[model samples]
Target: MPTYAIGDLQGCYLELRALLDRLAFDPQVDRLWFVGDLVNRGPDSLKVLRFVHDLGEAALVVLGNHDLHLLALAAGNSRHAKKSTLEAVLRAPDRDELLHWLRHRPLLHHDPERNFTLIHAGLPPQWDLAEAQVRAGELEAVLRGTDYQDFLRDLYGNQPDRWSPDLTGLKRLRFITNCLTRLRFCKPDGTLALTEKGSLENHTVGLVPWFRAAGRKTRSDRIIFGHWSTLGYRQEDNVWAIDSGCLWGGALTAIRLDATSLIPIQLNCKGYLAPGQD
Candidate 1:
């Protein structure tokens, strides 16, 4: 009856396995909630994807930015960025199934019983719990429907940096996707600054992390998210930023829902990626 929420994997399968073992995770009894980014970067992307897929209902995963990138790449909508590392997943025999599963995973998940909200990235400072669910559903429908490819094709870029219900077409979809997956810092006006992916110290003036927006609105429920590797494991009563960059020589982190404590397992990511990178 234990439930654990884990941070990004990013193809670090050995670390994931070790973390699970540290928790003594029993698929028959415990549930694992993954913050996503299950592939890319480190190594063994294929193994990580396959193992998670095999876990089935034992695991709940929200799509991360990297996970969506894999789907888009599979659909021929994306290309590898510099320092990209997803070849093993792309070449896996089960690539199609893995990608399909990833594409269908929800953009946002809420558990009322636990009073917890899960997403790959944090919610916008403006959205309340209801708005988040409603908007998430809109994008979810598009992602799971015939027009999914169209959504993926227009899923990049930083235009229309602000959220507007009236924003239409690809611009609209891309904005939503970014907010849910890759968002970090934003202007006081709620416009996203997507290009600034550096640590907190590297942030520019007039731009604050999305979670710190003043006079902002989002669910009062606890939100758990990954994607910001620099933030590491942070908890502030109702907010959790658990991505510790295990693929980058950090530790894999997990939190128990019943108790507000976190369990961290270190990784020897040496030689997992290019030398000196991790």
Candidate 2:
């Protein structure tokens, strides 16, 4: 009955298998929580997607930025950026099923019993747990509906970096997607800095990591997220940044949900493709 939350697979299926094997994962009883980035920028995106998609009730995954990009690309709204590593997934025999399953996944999930919230990226400073869940549900409905491809087609771009409840149509949907999957740092006034994916020290003067926002309003529960591999693993009062660059020749990381302390499981991520590299 143990549950483990793993960070950014990024299509590192070998490492994912090694780590899970080390944990002796039992699909019959054990539950796995994935922080997302299940594919792209790593070897074996197809294998990873199929493995998780087959896990069914044994696993729960939130949608990461790369995951959304794959969906958008499949919808003919995005183009492969030359160095993209998702070719395998895109060309897989079950590509349709894989992409369809990804688009239907939620942006956020909260476990009241564990007092943990799982998201691909950190929550906006202004959103509490309840607000995040409600907002995620709103976007989830849009993603799972018949108009999903419509939303995916117009999903890129980072203008209107601020959150406004009255924002309508694609702009509104993109805003939510940015916050849930692509967010990293934000201005003091809570404007997302979508282009600034560098280290914390290199951020612009007014930019602050979303999780480090002063007096952040979203402190109701601990948030576990993956996306900023540069930030690696960080634990604060109630936020966990668990993406430790496993696809970058680094080790994969996982945490036990019921334990008070962090228990990490490492694997040899050799020959993996990470961000910023071919």
Candidate 3:
């Protein structure tokens, strides 16, 4: 009955398995909550996708930016994507099945009973759990809907860098997608710094990490998120930052969600892509 929350797996399938084994993970009973980036940037995107997709109900995955990029590329929206490891996945016999399952994954997964919310990235300071859940649902509906191709076509952007209750249409969905999957630092007033990819020690001035925003609505809530591998595995201000740069020769981290105390278990990764390689 144990449950664990794992960090980004940017196609590090071997590392994922090693970490799982280190956790003594039992698929027959224990469950896994993935922070996403299940594919791309490493040597095993197709294998990673298939392994997680085959897990069925035993695994819960939130969509990450890389995951969405893979989807967009598959949707024919990637007219200019850079060199990517996702080619293996796209050429696989089960490509459609893998992509479909990935497409259906949510941007946010909240377990009300456990009072723990899982997101692939940061949340804007303006959104409380309720608001975040609603916005997440809206985006999820679009991604899982029939017109998803259209949404994918227009998904890449950093516009409308602020949240407004009146936002609608593509901008609204895109904003939601960004916060839930790509956010890192943002202003006090919830102005997003989507391009800020540096670690906390080197982030630009005037903006704070979303989890550190003084006015953050979900500050009192427990959040488990990845995406900022540079941020490493940190637990502070009631948020867990677990993407410990597994794809960059760091570690694949995991926390026991059902534990009485927070303890991170990690598996060292053999250096894959170097920094800035992606």
Candidate 4:
């Protein structure tokens, strides 16, 4: 049995299927770990959600920013900022069931036996695998609980960008949320730069990709993450970044995680949306 970690789908259902075909994947004997953003901005978000949801125990997932945005929209707590391809999913007859399943997904996943931690975006330098899991649980409790709508309403902020053991309430939740789903770069002290969507080499000073931050606690553990399409495919510094901007004319990628070597299986994508659209 093989377990593959896939990149952000962003509703590119056909590309996902194509990539799977290239892998010769069999759900009965193979498992999948999705790095989130399973829907948004592509042609077949509803189909993608339905397909992944029906996979049951064969698929494990962490929630991405777009996935959370869809949930927030379903909860009537947030509006789509620009273009959104999630309306069909929201209006589907099985919308409630699908959204319910999605809402319960975690922000982080760590396979202790394999020693691989999976997240949608990036982790702050401050946390080790243990603290990361705990903080993720804190936010997960709110999103999966009855007060989910209230938290969703307050989800779209950049305050409390720096993580602290002293942080509490919504502020704490928001900071954790940003780091897990939207983080790309940060200062050495783990101050998150949520707005910096460009690549790390874009002449930015004093800000490094989260994995490159000094004294990162999880530096010794392998991490597989997506959500940084602009950063492209990276497998350095004990971290693997698999988001290849499939919705933005890049390729959809999947890496076999349990294998001793890393060679990404890629499927070229149609330019459904231009770069920077997201």
Candidate 5:
């Protein structure tokens, strides 16, 4: 079966439908891997969430930062102001079911047979495949556990921005969450520079895209990720970025993972949110 990895949807259901149609995707045969952020910022978050949730075995998703924010808001963690176009989801009749399914989504997905890993954002240079799996599991357990609300309450911070074996408790979980869902640039020593979300050409000195960081352990493995829409579609050093900024008028993109060469299928999107709107 061919596997198609898609970029962040961000609630653009119309664009998603168009893109899938363009690919002539058959849910019965072609497997879909979504790089998270399935909801928020677009006009149809509810529809998008419902469609993906109903895909069942045909779809695999790793939670994005926006997805996590939705879960946090649903959990009553209102530390940050709610600025997303997620009200449709929050008020949906099936909100509980949808949020429950979203909360259970993994932070990282790996397919050894295909030699590709999926994450919403980049992994720290220090973690090899095994270490990344272990760290992701730790955070996943918290998000899926009974005490998830407690964790969500403390989840919105940028402190402890660097990874360390000695880091513990919420701090450790926060670091892991950021790397898996929101990371972009990092210092040469592997410390995350979370504020730098612009494209690589505009990056400051000594900061490198996490994938290009020195001695990255997963550099040997093919990585498929999103969360850096500003960087657009990138394929370099075994890393593939498919976030074509669908909400920002870029294309909703998908690339076939079953082929020797990644082939992108895109549908031009109507800009739902202008640049700097979010």
Candidate 6:
């Protein structure tokens, strides 16, 4: 069975449907891996969520920052100043069931058989594959546990910009969440520059894309991620980035994960949001 890993959906349901048509995807035989951000920032977030949820076992998803934000909003943790485009989903009749399903999604997915790992964003340099999995599990437990609402309420922060083995409590969880779903650039010493959202060349001096940070422990692992649409599709240093800015009038990209060499297929999108709009 062929498995195709797709970039962030970001509520672009029409483009997602068109991309699937282009791939001639057969849910019965082929598998799909979605690099999260399945909702918010575009039209039809409700439809997008329902469609992916209906896919059942055919789809695999890792939670993105936007997805977590949706969960937080649903839980009444509306501390964000900017309004989100998730009202449709929040008002749906099956909202509780949908949110339940979303909350249970993993922070990281690793398939040893395929020798590939999937995440919504980049991993910290200090975490090798084993450590990454452990940290993901720790955060996942909190997200799915009874105290999830408390965690959600305290989840928004940029502190503890670096990782440490001694880190504990909410700070530790926040750092793990940021690295897995919101990270882009980091200093050579692995301190996150979470505010930088520009293209590779436009990054601040001494800051490098997370995968390029010196002594990155996951350098030898085959990793697939989304969440950096500005960085777009990249396949350098054993990392595969498929988020081709589908929400920004760029292409919606998918790469065949079953192939030895990455084969990308993209559909030009009729964008819902222009650059600089979000």
TM-score of each: 0.92, 0.94, 0.98, 0.97, 0.98, 0.98
Lowest lDDT 10-residue stretch of candidate 3: 77-86
Q: Per-residue lDDT tens digits of candidate 2, residues 1-278?
A: 68999999988888899999999999999999999889887778899999999999999999998888888887787555565677777788888888888888889988888878899987677777777888889889998999888888888898779888888888878888899999999988888899888877776788999988876787657889989888888888778888888988767888888876776666656646545664
> Model 3 off-target regions past 4 Å?
none
Q: What is candidate 6's lDDT per residue for 118-220, written digit by digit as tens?
A: 9999998999999999999999999999999999988899988999989999999999999999999999899999998888978788889999999999999
Kindly report which residue stretches of model 1 are placed more than 4 angstroms away from their true locations once superposed: 81-83, 260-278
Candidate 6 lDDT trough over 10 residues, lowest sum? 74-83
Instruction: Please give the distance, in angstroms, between residue 7's alpha carbon in candidate 3 and its true position after superposition.
Output: 0.3
lDDT at position 268, candidate 4: 85
lDDT of 5 by residue, 1-278 (tens): 98999999999999988888888888998899999999878888899999998989999999999899889888788765458778888898999999999999999999989989999999999999899999999999999999999999888888898888999999999999999999999999999999887788887888999999999999899999999888888899999999999999988889999998897888888788897776
RMSD of each: 2.2, 1.7, 1.0, 1.1, 0.9, 0.9
lDDT tens digits by residue: candidate 4, 1-278: 79999999988888899999999989999999999999988899999999999999999999999999998787775556455778899889999999999999999999988889999998898899999999999999998899899889777888988888999888999999999999998986888977877786783688888999999999998999999988888889789999998989988989998888889988888869888664
lDDT of 3 by residue, 104-220 (tens): 998899998998999999899888999899999999898899999999988888998999988889989889999999999998788999999988788788888999887799999
Error of 1 at 50 (Å): 0.5
Sorted by TM-score, highest first, which candidate order results?
Answer: 6, 5, 3, 4, 2, 1
Q: Which candidate would rank higher by lDDT, 4 or 5?
A: 5
Where does candidate 6 stray beyond 4 Å? Answer: none
Clashing pairs in 1: none
Pull out the clashing pairs in model 2: none
Flag the better candidate by lDDT, 2 or 4. 4
lDDT of 4 at 21: 91
lDDT (0-100) at residue 216 of candidate 4?
A: 94
lDDT of 1 by residue, 12-59 (tens): 888889888888999999999999888877777888888999999999
Using lDDT, give the best candidate's number.
6
Clashing pairs in 6: none
